[model samples]
Target: MKLIRYGEPGHERIGVQINEVNYDVSAFGGDYDESFFASNGLARLDEFVKANAGNLIAIAEEERIAAPFTRPSKIVCIGLNYKDHAEETGATIPAEPIIFMKSTTALAGPNDQVMIPRNSKKTDWEVEFGIVIGKKASYVDESEALNYVAGYVLHNDVSEREFQIERGGTWDKGKGCDTFAPMGPVLTTADEIPDINQVGLWLKVNGKLYQNGNTSNLIFSVPFIVSYVSQFMTLLPGDVISTGTPAGVGLGFNPPIYLQAGDIIELGADYLGTQRQEVIAFQKN
Candidate 1:
């Protein structure tokens, strides 16, 4: 099942995509948040969709789409999980996954506008594969990692290079800006992706492709990442764990390229779906 959430920004409702058509599943009476995942919601939602197949309303083409699930407790990310991406930035391969956190406020719709934070010049993009936890996990074993995964998501790990590398602090600052974590046109359930490791992921600025790589290049496999992360902290249901990006980020270029207002960023992964965000200047509130 490809899960979706759509409507006005704050009033987004539950939905499911079938045969490329979005269908209303709100009658299932769930918001698809932490509680939903913790209580076997995927299986329940699947049954609901199947039971209401003929009666579900098809969402209009113009409705707003948001991340498939409501904001989780956190958005955990891995840095340099791809060997090529690590080398591109002139860094040694990590002995273990490099973990960082992106603030929940950073969450935005896949097609939402990506705001360049104030006083920023090095805003960059990273097309990454993301995981959605199905249940609470703490010190989970690698062999049991996949059992805790509900599905996968396409993530735009938007970053500010200067704040991330030169600001002398954790990567979270550059990574946690509002609108930096646009995710999901749809969330593809785990069952659909036969082999998650072989999936392809990519990104483009405007019309030209900039990042194109596959999970095959990952230095740490999916199960290892999940199990590894669980060892440090408890991952709640619906938590997002971004698996890191591949090579071709702006920072990798001899002369780094960054985003400017009016730029378009598009990214996608197999089964996980695609995301399209427009770059916009930061607006003061």
Candidate 2:
């Protein structure tokens, strides 16, 4: 099922998309968040859809689409997991996955304007597949990791290269800016996608192709990442695990190409839906 949230930024209502038409499911009685995922809420939602198949309200065309889920406990990201991306960044294949965290405040609607942080000159984009955890997982085995996943979403891991690299700090410095992580048109359940590792993902800036790659190139794979991450820290329900990006990022270019005011970016993956963001300059208060 294609689960969604639509409305203003902080007041979005639960929705479900079927047969390409969106229907309001706010009657289901709760927001999509950590508690919902931890309690097998998807199954309940499935039942609700089945019982109210023809009675669900059709959402108005003007309503805005927000990120599919509420603010997660955290957003964990894996870097250099893609062989091509690792090679492009001139880094060796890591013996294990490289993990980082993006501040929860960075979450924004899929089609919202991307804010170029104040004093920023090296903002960039990364098209990646994201995992939504279903249950609390700690020290999980790779073989059992898939059982703890709720769904997947398309994510643009926007970055600031100078703050990430030249500033002499962790990548999180450049990655956690507000609106840097614009996710979803919808969150697709894991059952809907048969093989998560074989999907194709791509993105473009100003109508020009910048990232065109597939999950097949991931060096560590999803199961390994989830299991590996659980060993050190507990992964709470509704937390996002961005699986990293493939090559063709601005940082991978000869001279590099960063985002500027008025630039339009579009990106998507099969089954995960698409998103478009218009770029604008940051304004100081």
Candidate 1 Cα deviation (angstroms), residue 33: 0.4
Question: What tens-digit string does per-residue lDDT give for candidate 2 at 121-182?
Answer: 99999999999999999999999999999999999999999999889868899999999999
Residue 186 local lDDT, model 2: 89
Candidate 2 pairs with clashing backbones: none
Model 2: how far is 162 from its true place, Å? Answer: 0.4
lDDT of each: 0.94, 0.94
Model number with the top TM-score: 1
The alpha-carbon lDDT assigned to residue 57 of candidate 2 equals 92
Shift in Å, residue 275, candidate 1? 1.2
Cα miss at 145, model 2 (Å)?
A: 0.2
Kindly give the stretch of ten consecutive residues in candidate 2 with the minimal lDDT sum: 276-285
